[model samples]
Target: MALASPTVAQAQSGTAAQCQTSGANSVPELHKEWILVGWDKPVAGQSWDFREKLGKYYDWEANDVVLYDDMSPDFQIARSPEEYRALWESSFQALRRAHHLVLNGPEVIAGDKLSTSTLEFAARLEPPESQPIISVRARSTLVWRCTSDGWRIVREHNSTRRITPEESRQLFGF
Candidate 1:
């Protein structure tokens, strides 16, 4: 498929009518769903397409993300939508380069979206036949800018920390 260009979502409406008034103010479940769609697994060269998919769920224009308060240093405090796409591509490439052995999903986490669901899932990496798949959640405390197409992840304090089986037991009580 083609990559997501600056104009791909030009024809789509940036704001949904009803969504403009109510949904405009806060994050919605649809936003989460859109993320799931784009993030189920790392897409090779299809990053822009995924971003377009996410745009469908929002009534805002996705520009770039910027950060205010950050507790992580591995990522930048701000990012453009295009920048976010590039970051994803970088990590996905890393996984491939490492020949990582990954597991499939439900990819369940221990919490809900209520601030409790603070896990940022990216892509997991593991040794073949390992006891458990390492979980990597990509997260950013940056801001999302609304673009003509939809909500774009602009800023990021992205992190991909590995979770060991022992840690998983501690976090999930499994």
Candidate 2:
């Protein structure tokens, strides 16, 4: 499924209205939608196409954007949009199937220009061809800034811990 791209003016106004009315309360739903888009099954013989959504969801043009993931090397920072894209693309390429479920609060703190939220989620990742599926529970904090384009993520920190197969079954009912 293709996501529709709103005109710049529409995005700006829509973002402002969203901030004024729902504030960061709407971020969790948006996050879920993004995850749904990310997890869309790829066509045979093709890789997942995330370039458009990546541009829409992230503030790639911002110099201050940063991402830290526990899965990455210790102290390794993805400081540029290209670095972030590389990381995600490489990770997605290794996965035959990926399932991510929001398991807890996106407790939010909203401000005029920025918003922060924390989310807890469970992930079940299946590797290529008969490999064992990996399951984990993770927590992430995201900082979003209202920019000319829309509400874009500027900072993120994520940590994860592996879950036992039984625990994964309990959480996801696979």
Candidate 3:
């Protein structure tokens, strides 16, 4: 009997993504997932993929993740796993439906078991036919920690500036 070869995802040279580590632990999978879900177009099974990974990555007991989203008027604090999951799901539902999303210029710093990253990204939303296009260029900061399971976000904050009509024309080719 011939043995089956391990798939690339399993036999790859390194982890899914890379982050600055002072010669220590790396949370590549978590990093990659973050980028993909942030910018890439929605893909089949992505919602479930995020659900499973997030459940494993977040520290439910500590529940330290605080999300300050530009779209929300109040800060969202998750004190438990369920709360975190719900918040994430709600956010993902909206993001996953975006017409276009792009992540750019991400910089990350890693320490003994903690890391911080910041990036600028853009998202465009176009409603049904004969509607206007809305876009935003936002800056986001994320703080992550390495737990026994893996790396998990402890804090996140995002702010955005709306793109003017001219800028929108250039951006969306309207």
Top-TM-score structure, candidate number: 2
lDDT of 1 by residue, 1-174 (tens): 986665644333334212222254333333344445544444433333435543343223334334322322355443444444444544433332111222222122221111111224344433234334555434533233343443433333444566676655554444
The digit string of per-residue lDDT tens for model 3 on 1-174 reads: 875467754432233233335333344434445544533444423443345645554556564656566654365665555665665555444443453344554577766467777776666654333555567878877777655455677776778888887776676565
Candidate 2: tens digits of C-alpha lDDT, residues 18-91: 55426333565555555546544334334665576556677878899898888774557898666777777766
Stretches > 4 Å off in candidate 1: 1-26, 42-64, 67-74, 93-123, 126-133, 136-161, 167-174
- Candidate 3 error regions (>4 Å): 1-32, 38-57, 73-96, 99-103, 127-132, 165-174
Q: Report how far residue 128 has shifted in candidate 2, in Å.
A: 1.0
The global Cα lDDT (0 to 1) of model 1 is: 0.37
- The residue ranges of model 2 lying beyond 4 angstroms of the native Cα positions read 1-25, 39-46, 73-75
lDDT of each: 0.37, 0.72, 0.57
What lDDT does model 2 reach? Answer: 0.72
